[model samples]
Target: MLLAVGKAAGPEKTLTERYVERAAKAGRAMGLTGFDVRELPDGDGPTRADREAASILAKRGRGVLVALDERGKALTSEEFAAFLQGFADDARDVTFAIGGADGHPPSLRQAADHVLSLSTLTLPHQLARVMLAEQIYRAVTLCIGHPYHRV
Candidate 1:
């Protein structure tokens, strides 16, 4: 789920929604059960992240937790595919957390089973969501032996 900066407006909202749809379709086609997105209110400090983390954890129950942050480990598409394959092999749920501007709380990081970085360059939270969705779809394709990923 994404902790959006409140509600988005106009084109930004549209683009994000589109990416979500594409991701869900691609994931399902690749044999994932489904994809769901949840939204949390925007906030200023670590407390907010803690709340977001709690909400996610409550919902996740028992599953692998992945936190997205700039400080996390970077992986190639193939490596990401392998990462997803590990969870799939174990039949576990994977919950990915996207924090707000101030970034995630230390508690959130501590709670994460894995912390992954999308890129070295910083991206707006909105764009990060889209990029993450696209990469997830690509990873699924790679897992299913689809040609969507060239390498």
Candidate 2:
């Protein structure tokens, strides 16, 4: 699952949806069910981050929670594939979270099973989703021995 604070407006939404659909289709061969996204309203004010954090946390299920933040451990594509494979091996769900404009609160960041840095630079939440969705598609391809992620 991919959960973000706000909906992607134009091209970002199209790209995200495209990648998610690709991942889901590829994932079926790997015994994966879905690659879905949930969009929440942008939290406002000084408490926005915390409020969004609460909302994201509330939606967290038995899956692994991965928070996307700048201050996170960066992983290579292969390493990320292994990380995901470990969860899939255990038949677990994984939720990749993207926060509001203010980014994730410390609570959500700390509570995440793994904190991932998409890039060293900060990104708009929508673009982050697009990036994440593409990575997910790539990862699924890698997992099933597809050539989509050729080096």
Candidate 3:
């Protein structure tokens, strides 16, 4: 599941839905279940990000936890595919968390099993959500050796 803070609207929402749907269909074909996106309300102030982080951690599962941050380690699409495949092979679940405007706090980063960055550049929360969804689709395709992820 992809946990994102803030409601997605307009083009961002459309693209996100498009990729998520694509991912769901392809994933189902490959026996990957539960491709769902959960949206959370955005908060404010200095504690907003921390509050959101806490909420995410609490809501996440016992499997692999990944926090999205601009400074996190970057991975190639193929590498990401392998990373997720390793967990899938182990029958472990994976959850991805996207923080709000203030970004994830240090505690959240430390608590996450992996801090992943789609790009080093700072992206808006909604756009970041779209990127994540698309990458997830790509990862699934790559794992199944599908054409969606052409080298």
TM-score leader = 2
The lDDT of each candidate is 0.75, 0.91, 0.89
Q: Pick the candidate with the highest lDDT.
A: 2
Error of 2 at 93 (Å): 0.6
lDDT of 2 by residue, 1-66 (tens): 988998778999999999999999998988888889999888988899999999999998888999
* Local error of candidate 1 at residue 49 (angstroms): 3.0
Per-residue lDDT of 36 in model 2: 95
Displacement of the residue 48 alpha carbon in candidate 1, Å: 3.1
lDDT of 3 by residue, 1-151 (tens): 8889888899999999999999888877667776788887787887999889988988888888999999999999999989888877787888999999999999999999999999999999999989999999999899888998876
Q: Which ten residues in a row have the lowest lDDT in candidate 2?
A: 79-88
User: Candidate 3: lDDT over CA atoms?
Assistant: 0.89
The estimated TM-scores of all candidates read 0.84, 0.98, 0.96
In model 3, the worst 10-residue window by lDDT is 27-36
Q: Which stretches of candidate 1 lie over 4 Å from their true place?
A: 1-12, 44-46
Give the per-residue lDDT of model 1 (tens digit) for 42-132: 7555477677667666665477888888889999999998998888777777878787766677888888899899998887777777778
Candidate 3 local Cα displacement, residue 44, angstroms: 1.7
